[model samples]
Target: MTTSHVPAGAHPNDGHAGPRVGLFVTCLVDLFRPTVGFATVALLERAGCRVEVPRHQTCCGQPAYNSGDRKEAAAIARQVIAAFDGYDHVVVPSGSCAGMLRVHYPSLFEDDPDWGPRAQDLAGRTHELTSFLVDVTGVQAVNDQRHDATVTYHDACSGLRELRVKAQPRQLLASVAGLTLLELPDTETCCGFGGTFCVKYPEISDRMVTEKAEMVASTGADTLLAGDLGCLMNLSGKLHRLGKAVSARHVAEVLAGMTDVPPIGAADGGDRR
Candidate 1:
């Protein structure tokens, strides 16, 4: 497999008077889907945000938090908080990582008087990319881009349930020209890539993703889109194995009108811009 490809985003603070924002590029996105991160920056820039990629940033500590390792997670959380606390807002392309900052970080430092308030502050500003676009900036639509494909949008578990991110992405997708939006059956159903859950319970995860692949194929959509990279990878992986001719992409990539990168799970470097 090829390494993730990073796109060159416009420099933040490029003499623009937008809100100072930090882009929290998640681990999976950094290693496997860098286009999502770049697309996020593009969307933010278009939304009037001066986006910065904090060099000190690391994982959101979700792996440790979910594994019941609060000590390590908290330590990592402190580092993350320090890295992003200076920004006016912190945005993430992946909902799970956003949830880590928006929901879990506060809980991680609840008992500490020092880091507790800091965590709460960061949590309050952190938002999923689509949610930030719609709810915060009040931007109803993105710059209309031409993508003539019927696509199904998967509501990743965390973004849908945790961040309440159902309408924001759909609302933006509506603005894109020549894009037909098809609803995935049971769109809210988990893709069974619950971070480490798939690793621990491969059989059950496979079963769930198999059903998801079938539903995605059933939609007759040519493309599969989701806000979370992990879910995209899981569902895309299953669909690939089943020989489904669907292109999987992050919603940010489409919303940002980026056509230069391959789809998330393309086997032969397909979906080139």
Candidate 2:
């Protein structure tokens, strides 16, 4: 979507001396929702990070890795490792991608001698976006952004179970003015978008997401927010099919005040910008 990396001097490196963050804009965010990528950059810059979108960055090989294709996954992981080398931290907007980098990359190379050490080093620095802002940068609040909606948060499985991203996004959302967060029923349940899992078992996936969407609707919140785009897209599509009124968005959009674009799975399907 024509998004440029945050170069030096674009934002002052004040608080944390601008940790070099290599933004791993996931494939979904890059193709379906570019606003999330832009919002992530805004939030990182606000927290005093010198961000860069490495041109060589590609998919985290999550689909292949999950599909029992270790050979291809390892090849892609090697490329990702090389692309994000030299950065102080590699931050991803999606928890699933971040989890792959932080949790799975090392295991993929554990038996190897050369790439194994490199994978561990990179994994240590990998972090989800909200977690990086709150934990690594010590950012307590977001400034100048407000959402006056009755919002419900869905705990994406990867972010919640894998990365323990339970409270980081909520902690920041609490700082947002005019926002009311209503907890969703069974927030920890999967929305059924397990990377390639949905494609493999559409019937099972649809059933799970249908239940999740019903839970979201039961919350009676006007908006639904989640850390991972995959979950959001799955729920958003289900909600639309059910004719539910809730709008779905990446949490970074509201936190960074970049919600001028249409919500995910809108009737018009949103622009690529």
Q: What's each prediction's TM-score?
A: 0.93, 0.93
Model 2 lowest lDDT segment of ten: 1-10
- TM-score of candidate 2 versus the correct structure, residues matched by position: 0.93
Best by lDDT: 2
Alpha carbon lDDT of each predicted model: 0.86, 0.88
**For residues 101-215, what per-residue lDDT tens digits would candidate 1 score against the true structure?**
9999998899999999999999999999999988897877765477888999999999888889999899989988899999987887898999999999999999999999999
Q: What is the lDDT of residue 221 in candidate 2?
A: 90
What lDDT would candidate 1 get against the real structure? 0.86
CA lDDT of 52 in candidate 2?
91
After superposing candidate 1 on the true structure, give the runs of residues whose Cα lies further than 4 Å from its correct spot.
Answer: 1-14, 267-273
Off by over 4 Å in 2: 1-10, 14-16, 268-273
Task: Quote the positional error of residue 267 for candidate 2 in Å.
Answer: 3.8
